[model samples]
Target: MIELLVNLIVSVMAAATPLLLAATGELIVEKVAVLNLGVEGMMLMGAIAGFAVAHETGQLWLALLAAIAAGMTLSFLFAVLTLTLQANQTATGLALTIFGRGFSALVGAGYVGIAAPTLPKIHLPVLSDLPFFGATLFSYDPLIYLALILLAATAYFLTRTHAGLILRAVGDQHDAAHVLGYRVIRIRYLAVLFGGAMAGLAGAYMSLSYTPLWAQDMIAGRGWVALALVTFAAWRPFWLLIGAWLFGGIMYLSLYVQGLGVPVPSAMLSALPYVGTVVVLVLISRDHRRIRLHRPAMLGRPFQATN
Candidate 1:
């Protein structure tokens, strides 16, 4: 029983890693009120970019950097369209998703069969030896642990810092922030890019560390799930972690059952996480008065300097 439980925990962590990373990034982005629907697109871009770079160079660090760069670069396009050009944020974001998917497919075609090197684990002395949890929680690939650190730091950064307060001000009310002499647009730009980079990095890690291979549409709607997670957490970082892990566990449990020869049908198992996504979405939408209904206030609303 314990062994089965251990394996289950490990699988859940692995499954949750990419979602956690992406959700953490989005949480930061939404905190500043710029909703970028291109997370899946950026993640797909990072997945291929990181995979191609790592395949050529065999460097994990370089792969991660390339992935983040790709994500941020794409995000800049989003910023230009939504922020500067005043394009419809929703339409533009969805367009980016279509563009990213098709673009990632084209780029990934050449490296269909190749596998990128994986990230290495850092095992702590004495701590990693603590029966099940030591390996399950403490002894993970460095990025897995890094995901936790990102979560904690983000939680602190949002709740503790002056900059955080200022960013919140901008998201919650842009005109007021501008009236206070704050660079509302500039702060938002930074927030969007930060969100993009983190979202991209999350995608990169999925490719390099988790999947370790390139494919078409491999992000598998994790981006939308991350968006939903923001509402589940009520814009709070700790709930973001919980929501991400819950979804991740659903994803991993489906596979683990198959691996363990559980009697459940494969089709049902595979569809579970997505099914859960719909259920959660319904629950989030059940409330209308709340501001963060999977979206921050002033999100998708243009913030013009004069208007």
Candidate 2:
């Protein structure tokens, strides 16, 4: 039983990695009051690009880099449309998601059934070879640790840094930020690109680490879940980690239970994460004031500088 429990814990952490990374990125993006809904799209593009590059070049790092570039490229398009052209953020984000889905599918056609090299685990000397706890906690790919570091960095940046203060000020009141001579558009552009890069890294993890292969629509709505996670976390980085792990535990549990021959429907198991997302959103939405307090004041609104 203890071994089984250990295995479950490890699986849950692995499952949560991608969501955690994506949510961290979105937290930064929304911190600057720019809502980029192309996370799913960016992730898909990253998955395909990472898989293709890794498959052909046998270089995992290059594959990950390709994924980041793919994600940033899509995000740049989003920035241009919304920040420069003042397009509707919602419509453009949705369209970008659709475009990513189709584009990734077309790009991944030849790579179907191709198996790329899996990401290597960093086996520390004494820590990795210890008993159950060591294997459970220390045996994951590098990206897992990177996610935790990212969470810490994000929390510190938002709470303890001057630049973070500037970002929050810009998000809370872009016009006020503009009045203070801060470049609101440029800040938001950087935030969006960062968000996209994180999302892409998450996608690359799916292909090069999680499943280690590519398939059509392989991101499988993880992007949307990450988006919902931002609300579940109430826009805080620490809470985002909790929400992501909770959802990840639930997702992994569903699969574990199915494997136990509980006679549960596979469809129901698959729906667990989405159902959890709804429940979380509903619970958080019940307190309108709390939502108002943490939410960026200028989110989803376009900014323009007037001379």
Candidate 3:
């Protein structure tokens, strides 16, 4: 029973890794009061880009870099439209999702059946030789550790750093930030790009590490889940980590039940994650003050610097 539980936790961490990375990126984006709804689309583009490059070059690192570049490119377009042209954030984000889906399908058509180079798992010299703990913690691909590191780094940056404070100031009061001579749009651009890079990394994790294959819409709504996760986490990095693991556990529980020969419908099992998302959102929404306190004050609002 202990072994089984450990295995379940290991699987949950693998599944949750990508979501955690994506959510962390979105957290930063929202922190700057710019809601780029193109996360799903960016992820799709990253998946295909990473897959194609990995299949062709057999270089997993290059493939990951390609994914980051792809996501950043899409995000750059988003910044141009919304930040420069002042396009409606909602409409632009929706269009980006549609575009990414179609564009990725077209790009990935040739590589549909291609097998990608598997990422190497990090095995510690002595610890990895340990009986149970090593398998549970030290046997994951590098991306998994990177996700944890990112969570820690983000938490520190947000809570213990001055630049992070300034970013929060920008999110909370862009006009005030502008009065203090902080370039609101510039900071927002960096935040959006950083969000894009992380989304791409998440996509790379999905294709190169998680499943390591190419398929249509293979991201499978993970992007949307990540977006909802920011809300579910109340915009805090640590809370986001907990929320991601909870969702991941729920998803794996469905599969575990199915494997146990339970008579539950597979369709319902597949819907478990989304259902969990809805429930969490409802619970979070119930506390209006909590949401108000943590949510970016100027989220989704377009910023124009007054010279």
Candidate 4:
């Protein structure tokens, strides 16, 4: 039983990798009040771009870099519209999704059916050899480790650093941040770009590590799941980790249960993620206050520096 659970956890851990990367990055973006809803689109673009680059060059690293670059570059369009032109953030973000999807299909057509390169899994010297925790925690791809590190670093940055405080301030009150001599627009630009890069990386992971193949809309709605996780996690890094794991667990278990022949159809198994999402959302809605307190007040709002 324990071995089964461990194996299940290992598989779930792999499933959560991209979510962790996406949600973590989105968490940071929201912390600074730049809610980029284009995570899914960005991820899809990254998946394809990264796959194409890696497939052609045979260099996984370069391909991943190209994916992130593509995601970030595409995100700049959102930044310009929402930040510079003062368009609605939510609308612009959605449009980005549409654009990314089509662009990925157009540019990614030739690369269809090509195999993706995967990141190498590392075995921690002593830890990986340990009975349980080692395999579950230490035995994973480097990106998995990087995702974990990012969670910790983000938490610390949000709670401990001066710049983090300023970012939060900007997010909470752009006018106030500007009065305090902070560059609100500049800070938001950086935050959004950071978000785009992370979202891109998450997409790249899906292409390279998760499936090692590029499919049309392979990222599916993981980007949306990521968006939901930001709220599910109550905008906290630790919460993001937990949320990713919970979602990953649910998703993994949903598919695994089908293997158990529990009489559930495979078709129904696919709805598990979305169903869990709805149920969790309803649970959060019950509290209401909890979400308001944790949700960044400036999320989805545009910032202007009026000093």
Candidate 5:
């Protein structure tokens, strides 16, 4: 029983890590009042880039870096259009996603069906040998720990630092922030780029650690789930962790049940996580006050600096 429980926890954490990473990046972007709907596309690009690099070179670090670069490259385009040229954020972001999808598919065509090495798990000498705690807590790959560390750092940055306050200020009132010499466009650019890096890292995690192979649209709808996760978290980092795990468990539940010889249809089981996502969003939407209070005021709004 204990072994079974530990395995479940490990699986759920693996499932949750990518969602947590992607959502955390989106949360940062939204905090700066910039909404990039291209997260799905970014993740897809990262996945293919990471998979291709690892398959060719067999260097994990290079693959991860490649993933981040691919994501940032796409986001740089997003920044130029929306932040610099005053394009509509929503439309530009949608276009970015579409472009990422087609681009990744085209690039990944040659790499399909190829397998790559997975991330190495950490094995502490004595600690990792411990029966329950070792496997449950200390045995995960580095990215899992990095995700948690990043979340903690983000929470601290947003709530306990001067720069964080400035970021919130920009999101709340960009013009006012501009008047105060905060450089609203610059700060937002950094936020968007950081979001892209994180999304890329998340995509790498999916390909290198989760499945270790390339597949068309293997990200499925995880990018969308991460978006909904931000709202489910009410833009709070701590809640984002909770929500990621919840969704992760839901995602893994179908496989677990099927493995146990449950009679549920595979299609329905596959739909469980998305169904849970819709249900959670509907429930959360009913609470108008919470969302209004927590949502960034300048979110999805274009910023124009006046001299």
Candidate 6:
């Protein structure tokens, strides 16, 4: 029983890593009042790019870099359309996701079913040798740790730093921020790029670390889940972690239950995570006041500088 429990905990953490990474980035983007819904597309692009690079080059770091670059490239395009040309954020983001899905499918056609090297786990000397705690906490790959560290840094930057305050101000009142000499568009561009990079990293984690293979549409709505996660977290970093874990556990439960020979249809089990997402969204949506209080004032709204 203990062993089974330990394995479940590890699986949950691994499953949660990508969501946490992607949501962390989106949180930053929304904090600056820019809504880029291309996260799914970005993650798909990253997955293919990372898998291709890893399969050909055999370098884990290079694969990760490729994923980040792919995500950023898509995001840069998004910034140009939404920020510079003042396109509709929602439509552009949806289009980006579609493009990412089709493009990644084309790029990954030849690499299907090909296995690639997975990320190596970093086992600390004494700590990793400890009891159950060591396996649960110390036996994760670098990306997992990076996700946690990134979240911590983001939390600090958002709540404790002057720049965080500036970001919040920009999100709350872009016109006033521009009047105060803050380059509203530029700040949002940076935030969007950062969000893209993180999304890409999340994709890389899925390919290079999670499954370690190339598969079309393997992101499987995780991008959308990550978007929902930001709202579910109420745009708060700490709560984001909890939400990620909750969803992660829900995602992995299907597999664990199947392994235990539970009497349930496989298809229904696979839908558990998404179903949980909808249910959670419904519950959270009930509190309109809470969402209004925490949601970025300028979210999904286009910004223009009158100069």
lDDT of 6 by residue, 1-307 (tens): 8777778778999999999999999999999998889999999999999999999999999999999999999999999999999999999999989999999999999999989888999987898989867756678999999999999999999999999999998999999999999989999999999999999999999999998888889999999999999999999999999999999999999778877787898888989899999999999989999999999998888888874
Candidate 1 off by > 4 Å: 131-137, 262-264, 289-295
Choose 1 or 5, whichever is better by lDDT: 5
Candidate 4, residues 144-211, lDDT tens digits: the string is: 88889988999999999998999899888888888878888878878888888888889888888889
RMSD of each: 1.9, 1.0, 1.1, 1.6, 1.1, 1.1
List residue ranges in candidate 4 displaced over 4 A: 131-137
TM-score of each: 0.94, 0.98, 0.97, 0.95, 0.97, 0.98
- Model 1: how far residue 84 lies from native, Å: 0.7
- Lowest summed lDDT across 10 adjacent residues in model 5 is found at 130-139
RMSD of model 5 against the true structure: 1.1
The TM-score between candidate 3 and the true structure equals 0.97
Mark the regions of model 3 whose C-alpha exceeds 4 Å error after superposition: none
Number of the top lDDT candidate: 6
Where does candidate 1 clash, by residue pair? none
lDDT, candidate 2, 103-185, per-residue tens: 99999999999899888998877998898678666788998988899899989999999999999999999999999999999
lDDT of 4: 0.86
Candidate 1's residue-wise lDDT over 161-269, tens digit each?
A: 9888888888888899999899987888898888888888888888887787887898989888888887777788888888888998889877777888888889998
Writing each residue's lDDT as its tens digit, candidate 5 over 31-67 gives 9999999999999999999999998899999999999
Model 3, 1-307: lDDT tens per residue? 8788778878899889989998999999999998888899999999999999998898889999999999999988998999999999989888888999999999999988779897889987887788867766668899998999999999999999999999999999999999998989889889989999999999989989888888999999999999999999989999999988998888788888888888889889888888888998999899999999899999998888766
Stretches of model 5 off by over 4 angstroms after superposition: none
Question: What TM-score would you give candidate 2 relative to the actual structure?
Answer: 0.98
When summed lDDT is taken over every stretch of 10 residues in candidate 6, the lowest stretch is 131-140
State the C-alpha lDDT per candidate. Answer: 0.84, 0.92, 0.90, 0.86, 0.92, 0.94
Deviation in Å, model 4, residue 304 alpha carbon: 2.7
